[model samples]
Target: MSCQRGQYVTAAVVTAGAISGAYYAYRWYQENATKIPEQWTQVGTLKDIYAYPVKSCGPVIMNKAELSILGLKDGWLRDRFLMVVDEKNNFVTARAYPEMLLVHPSVKSSVLTLKHADMEPVHVNLAEVVTNQCAKTARVWGVEVPVFDCGHETSEWISRILDKSSNNFRLVYYASHGARTLRAGTSKIYRFTKNDTGALPDEVPFNLVNQASVDDLNTRLKETQVTPRNFRPNFVMKGGKAYDEDNWKFVKIGDNVFEIIKPCFRCILTTIDPETGVRNVNADPLETLKTYRQSTEPAARRSAGSSPRMGVQMSLRSAPGGLVKLDDPIYVA
Candidate 1:
């Protein structure tokens, strides 16, 4: 009877160990499974390239851009290389002042010209001030980044256009910094490699959107039409299904390659009109987007209240540069 009891106890222990091992193996699979795309397909053609020299301001449409991990090199400089901040060095964006959308920027011969409806155009020579020795720290997404102040003349000029009581808003340019460490609060999914670098962008160096996604959103709307400008994507592509960008792991445009890092989370800024800077009051697209496009991924969702994704953020995989042109075939790799 004692020998028989020992055999029974030994069998039970083996069974319990087998069950525990199986459970942990399944858990490990679930955690790492999302890293690669389940399917890859030829999606579209690169339709446009838009660069915003000043963050949250108008875009300068382009026919081509030199793709780089640092940012889109358009000869003049990189996108979001310059920014507008308040007196306290807090980043000022279209979310706070819808009028910011009215400020249009164009670059030619290394000169950045700012044009608005109600004010005279202001021009800043990029080559002249890009190397200014003085630097001050500014905040973007709670990150204290050092930037070169464009001087009081530029500040006064921007203030006049916005009709501010004081010249509190200043235009500052990024001087150079080594590889920026992603903040602790940032999602691990968007974490950068040791070689990754960044400028003054909200997150990634490039934002790409699909024209089909915009068309799909327009079909659901009965009130107004929204353009690619409202979303402020650096690269706009066409020919793919709406939201096809979400499934892309590796993509090639022209001769350059990029890694689709994350889906962009829509915010209240999308509700503001890109032309007039007036926000939609009756049927905001964000409100409608929340109905169908809400993401299950915590990192993909901007906040508990925001809607689904409209675009994707990407980083260059092929570097030091290659020219990506309009109508270039985009392939999933």
Candidate 2:
């Protein structure tokens, strides 16, 4: 009976070890395995392109744009090129000033025109701003970024539109003072050179949002159905399943190839209505997304607890800098 009990104990220990080993193997696969499937079908076309010259301000819709290594090169390579800063040079956005949504921007040739309903139209010469290389460092998300002060005249114009006192708000252009590098926590899938840089964008140089994903969220909302304007995507893709962009590793739009960096983690800005410049009291879509869209991968998760993600941030890979036109055929690569 003693020998039989000893054998039973040995069997239990082996079984426990096997179970633990299997659990760890599964966890490893979940973190390291490729999310891409064996066959990724072409499920979308580039339906829209938006360039936000100023962060948190209105966007300029385009039919065709040059895709450079940095980002969409539209009008002096001005996607998020200009940002509104406070007296201390801290970045401002619609999150703090909801009225920023009402500011509309349009570009024609060398001119960038800004219009607000309550204020007169403000125009700035894009070439002139680019030529003025006077560098000033400002804070975006608390990181000190080098920028070109757009002169006191342009700063006063923006302050007037924002309804702030003089010297309280200023508009600064990203002057590329030094090599702008990616943050430390980026995934290891892509490479960035010393010359690679970004403007005042929150993270990646470009953001791609699936039309189906927004449609899916609208269906789940209680009262307000949001549009692509609310999400502020550089490329809006059509003909994909809801949230299909999450698995895409790379895609070619027209002549430019883009690599997906990671899924875009959303914030309270989504709950704000772009048209009305008002935020939803209940946080409709974000509350609903947290229930289902949170990432399971360890690298994708921002922290122990963070908001769920919806779209994917992309990086430009094409070297020659080609034109990505409206309705460009999008193919998974």
Best by lDDT: 1
Alpha-carbon runs more than 4 Å astray in model 2: 1-40, 177-179, 184-197, 302-304
How high is the CA lDDT of each candidate model? 0.74, 0.72
Candidate 1 lDDT, tens digit per residue, 161-267?
Answer: 66564597899887553334565566666645533435777777888889999999999988988988888998888998998777777777876677777777888
- All candidates: TM-score: 0.83, 0.81
Model 1: which residue pairs collide?
A: none
Query: Could you give me the TM-score of model 1 versus the true structure?
Result: 0.83
Global lDDT of model 1? 0.74
Note the residue pairs that clash in candidate 2. Answer: none
Question: At residue 310, what lDDT does model 1 achieve?
Answer: 84
TM-score of 2: 0.81
